[model samples]
Target: MNLNESDMKVQEPRLWSSDGWTARVVKNEDDDGWAVAMTPDGASEPALVGPWTMGRDKKNPKPLDQSAFLTLVKTAREFVRRSEQQLHAALHQSIAVTVGTARVTVCLDITPDEDNPSATLSARDEGDDLLAQVRVPPSFKLSRSSAVAWAEGGFVKPR
Candidate 1:
């Protein structure tokens, strides 16, 4: 049968869509229980997956409802938000170092990509003016001592 746009829309009972999220109930392949997956709009995979409530018969999963779907969307959005915050903190780390009478800030920004992985070490004065920046290997670690050394060495690239 030829399917039109309206006909192609999924009408499965176990799947529900909300503002920008979708809740899907699937059987847990690892066990007899069921699980629900929450995926955000435009995302390929679910951002949150967890055990779901069982139906009265105990064989099938409880059907998705407005309350459950709303809760799942809230939880999945928070999970994605926290994940992004953690990744941002890891990628951009900074520390303050005391050099002479000025306090300088040293920041290590890392860009991780499969094709090209790189890191940059940058130093800024107390007023946040750029002092020196150099590209370093992705594996380079930033520490208080390293920052101090960089500042003491005239903001040169650390060995």
Candidate 2:
């Protein structure tokens, strides 16, 4: 009863766990077909869930094998990695523009909240010195023209 997760991993006909990932074959609630779920260790929900192959009998799901389990782990890992990259891109964005004789990096950081979303627009010089920052609308569009205009206008909060 005091064993750790390594000793409790289960590799059965419909389930497999290894390499910090688990693959489970379950009945698809939406239809008669079976489905496979790939969940990372310590995760509450699966990162990937899709259709599963049927057994020869066509009634049961195909038994999970080493090959299938490895494939599922690879796919699920990729899915999680891409999801993280997308979220980073959405929450933090930056662009470089020429402000007179100096180069400036404009950054937009968005904090998403159900009650009220917020965003901050900031600028940094080529030496990574904070030049100016202002609060902006969450819907503010960050583009080259907007960044140039902001710097040209003395870093004022854009209306």
- Top-TM-score structure, candidate number: 1
Clashing pairs in 1: none
Over 1-159, each residue of candidate 1 has an lDDT whose tens digit, in order, gives 884432333325699875777789998889999999988777889999999999999888888888788888889989999999999999999999889999999999999999999999999998889999999998889999989988899987877
Tell me the TM-score of each prediction against the true structure. Answer: 0.88, 0.87
* Candidate 2 per-residue lDDT over residues 1-159, each given as its tens digit: 597564567889998988888899999999999999998888889999999999999999999999889888888999999999999999999999998799999999999999999999999998999999999999999999999999999999999
Q: What are the runs in model 2 whose C-alpha is more than 4 Å off?
A: none
Cα deviation of 25, candidate 1, in Å: 0.6
lDDT: worst 10-residue window of model 1: 3-12
- Give residue 55's error in model 1 in angstroms: 1.3
lDDT of 1: 0.87
Residue pairs whose backbone atoms clash in candidate 2: none
Task: Look at candidate 2 and tell me the lDDT of residue 39.
Answer: 85
lDDT of each: 0.87, 0.93
